[model samples]
Target: MHIEQLKQKIVAALEDLKAQDLTILDVKAATSVTDYMIIASGTSSRQVMALARNVQSTAKELDVELLGMEGLDAGEWVLVDLGDILVHLMQPQIRELYDLEKLWGEFANPINHQA
Candidate 1:
């Protein structure tokens, strides 16, 4: 699928599970690994894991290549690698602590999805 369509699918998956504070960061200039980084907060570890699973399922349905996944065991945070896109699912505290937006602020074109 096209990157933008894949992005929209990922966003929809997260939204379906009520992911909070969804933010899409354009990190093409900031990183060589991926073009976009999608960050979202889940109410708890369980929710975080669920969000990750939903993303995975959606990607699979779209036949998008899955590069890798991390932090699923801990469930404090989970990262889904989709070649050109990275999805970060975390608890609110973890999200706050990491502060990815600020870290990538220089090159990031942040798009906030409010719902």
Candidate 2:
């Protein structure tokens, strides 16, 4: 799928699970790994895991290659690699510590998700 389409699918998946403070950073210039970085918060470990799984399943349905996934076992944070789009699912505290939005916030293109 195209990057934009993949982003939309991922965003939809996150929204479906009520991900909080969802943000999409345009990191094409900042990194060679991916074009966009999607960051979101889950209320708890189970929610975090569920959110990650949802995105993975969505990607599979769309035939989007999932390069890698991490933090599922810990559930404090989960990263989904969707070739051109990278997703980060985390709890409030873990999100605060990493502060990915702030780190790459300036580069982010606005997303329509509620914060």
Candidate 1: C-alpha lDDT: 0.93
Q: Which ten residues in a row have the lowest lDDT in candidate 1?
A: 106-115
Clashes of 1: 0
lDDT of 1 by residue, 1-115 (tens): 8999999999999999999999999988877999999999999999999999999999999999898999999999999999999999999999999899899988888976666
Q: List residue ranges in candidate 2 displaced over 4 A.
A: 106-115
Give per-residue CA lDDT, model 2, range 1-115, as digits (tens). 6778888888999899999888888888777888888999999999999999999999999988889999999999999988888899999999999898887867666565553
Candidate 2 pairs with clashing backbones: none
